[model samples]
Target: MASRSRLHVAVFLAPAVLVYTAVMIWPLFNTLRLSLYVEADGVRSFAGLANFATLFGDPRWSEAFWNALGNNFWFFVVHMLVQNPIGVALAAILSHPRLRFAALYRSAIFIPTILSFVIVGFAWKLILSPIWGIAPGILDAVGLKALFAPWLGREEYALTTLALISVWQFVGIPMMLIYAALLSIPEEILEAGEIDGITGWSAFWRIKLPLILPSIGIISILTFVGNFNAFDLIYAAQGALAGPDFSTDILGTFLYRTFFGFQLQLGDPHMGSAIATAMFAIILAGVCIYLFAIQTRMRRYQF
Candidate 1:
């Protein structure tokens, strides 16, 4: 009977394993292989690390690559410092026992997340348009009209503005995850804390926060992956150029522009693959750090 059960389990797993191998593992290795080769005069030849050397050493490619990478880092930072903390606060507030309309509030806050990237991008663009935008009018109403400008059209503010827009759209994800974590805490633990005179803010800080560390870690990792892989919103709003002097460009848009020839530049799959490989390396390194540094150090509390 044990042998029969084992056979059944193997059968159940086989199809999933095969699908994962075919769809994910194979394509990943293929891309990695492509990154090591170059096409010259309509012929593909193994170029070793030549492609990577050119990517880093060549002036034209290296500048754009570094620019996009830097922008991506800043993008990730904004989400980490602003979005996550705001989400945590909102989740804490909504999780209160006496809070009214909590579900309605959650759904309302989460509505933007469900909208398509195309929609959000275009909507925001229209709203922020300097010539005919409502932003100026709204600012005028609040007597802050002097602060209004074409934020998306300027090099200095474009990236930061887009990052904030992205944060506004996705804040709900962290909020929901943290909210669920907060709700999962055992009432008995809180009761004990109350008995010990640990109430309200003190109870949350000492008792609740530690238990939710794992969830926060997970949310952080997810945010890292998603922000690094982001493309659609930027493309939809700013075009392939990631304009205002390419200030809004990130790794994803850079990869796209590199992979598929943009404007006068011809497509080079080898270089595109190198960019992708680099991205894979970065994301892998982040996950490893989280797994080894953060996850291992976090003490998992049991109810």
Candidate 2:
């Protein structure tokens, strides 16, 4: 009977396994294999870890690699610091039973999340453009015209500007996730908290916040993965060069530039694969840490 049950499970799992292997597993294996080979003098050969060495040791490659990594970290940080907090706040507000027009507000916030990357990037580029953009006019109306600068064109401001744009585009994801989590909290638990004099902000802080920790953790990890994988918007706005002077280059763009030819260098699939492997390692490590260390502690707070 046990053998029959196991066979039943295998039969059900086989199709998904085959599809996963074809799409995800096979591509990952090929990338790893490609990462271990190098081309030299019109010949390609197994290079073991030499590609990784070059990625770190050679300044030409290492400098750009480090820069992209740092920029990527900043991008992630911006989302965590600005995006998630606002999402939680918005979710808290919208979850209120008496809040007026909540569905309309939710739909409006969420619409941007579904927009095409190119459209968002292109529209923002036009909005921020100095010559014809409305930003300066709006600032002028608000008596802060001097505050308006070429945000996307400046090295110091470009990444942050793009990060904020990204935040605007996707903040609704965490909001919706948190909203669902908030809604899932049993009324009895909330009533008990109320019986203890917990109400308003007190109720949210003592009751709702703790219950939603797991959802927030999931959202955080999702944000980490999504931000690390981000390339489309940056590419759409900045192109492959990621200019002004590669200020906004993240790992995805870096990998793209290395994997495909840019103005400066011919495509090097091996190095590109190495960069991809590194990105995988970083994301894997981060997820593992969250699952093992942080999540274990968070579970103690789970009711």
Candidate 3:
């Protein structure tokens, strides 16, 4: 009977397993295989970990790798600092019982989340452009025109500014996720808190906040993975060079440049594969840390 039940479960799971193997497992294996071989002068040869060695050992490759990694971290930090807080604030406001037009506000806030990265990037680029942009006009209307400059065109502010723009586009995601989580908390629990002399700010900080921590953890992990995987926005706004002197280059764009030739530098498939593998490893390590280390502790609380 046990063997029959096992067979039944396997039969039920077969289609999903097949699809997973075909779409995800197969491509991952292929990339890993390609990473093991080197191609040059129209010739391919097995290179073991030489590609990875060059990725880390060679200054030319290593410099860009480290720079991109650092930039990616900064991008992630910006989202954590600006985006999540803004999302939480908005979610708190929208969750208020007396708030009118809440549905409309939620929909409007979420609109940008559905937009393609290309559209968001170019729209922001045009909005921030100095020559024929509305940003300067708005600042001028506010009597702050002097502060307006081409932020996207400047090296010192480019990456940070772009990160803010991305935050603007995606903040809605966290807001919605957190809002739902907040709503899921029992109203009785909140009322109990109020009866126990906990209400308003105190209720939120001491009660609601702890309850929503698991959602925040999920958002943080998602942000980490999404930020590391991001490519389209930077590509659309700054091109593959991620210029303004490569100020916005992240692992995604760096891998793109390595995989495909740009200007004078020829593409190196092996190097690209190495970069991709490194990114995979980084993402895996982060997820593992979050799951094994942080998640266990976070889940121990009944809330």
Candidate 4:
């Protein structure tokens, strides 16, 4: 009977494992393999770390690579600073037992997350359009038209503007994660807090917040991964070039342009794979850091 049950479990898991291996594991190894070779005279040859050297040591490639990397970090920073905090606040509010229309509020906030990136990108782009966008008209009505500018068209403002737009679209993710964490707190714990005269904000700070630390950590790591992986929305909004002069270019866009080529540039698969490997290293390091922090916290709790 135990053997049969084990077989059942394996049967259920096999498809997903196979699919993951094919789509994810295979591509990853292939990209790494491709990165090791350089094309010369219409023939590919093993170049080892030469591609990586060029990426870091060569001025032309290194400049764009570093620029995109810096921009990607800024993008992640914006989401961390602006999106996660707002989501946490919203989750706190929505989790209030007395809060009315909580379902409606939750739905409204989260609906944007399910929308296609193309739709959100185009919608925001249209709304922010300088000539015919309603943003100017609405600002004019509110006596703040002076604040309106061609944000996407300007180098200084484009990346930040797009980052904020992304924040607006995805803020609800952290909210929902935190909300579930809040809901999962044992009733007995809350009762004990109340018995100790801990109530309302005090109860939350002394009791709830401590318990939800793990969930918050998870949300932070997820945001890091998601922000690093972000491509579709930026691509839809800014194109492969990630223009106004590549100000909005992140690693994903940079990889796309390098791997697939954009306009005058020809695709260099070896260089593209090198960039992808760098991204994998970055994400892996981030995940490892999060894991280390979690383990340290757990050890402290155990002690």
By lDDT, who's the top model here? Answer: 2
Error of 1 at 23 (Å): 2.0
lDDT score of residue 216 within candidate 3: 91
Per-residue lDDT, model 2, residue 20, is: 99
Candidate 1: residue 204 Cα off by (Å)? 1.4
Question: Which regions in candidate 1 have their CA more than 4 angstroms from the true location?
Answer: 1-5
| Candidate 2 per-residue C-alpha lDDT over 78-132 given as tens digits, one digit per residue, 9 for 90 to 100 | 9999999999999999999999999999999999999999999999999999999
Higher-ranked by TM-score: 1 or 4: 1
Error of 2 at 193 (Å): 1.3
lDDT of each: 0.94, 0.95, 0.92, 0.91
State the displacement of the C-alpha of residue 110, model 4, in Å, after optimal TM-score superposition.
0.4
lDDT of 4 by residue, 53-72 (tens): 99999999899999998998
Candidate 2 pairs with clashing backbones: none
User: Candidate 3: deviation at residue 172, Å?
Assistant: 0.9
What's the TM-score of each model vs. the native? 0.97, 0.97, 0.97, 0.93
Each model's total of backbone clashes: 0, 0, 0, 0
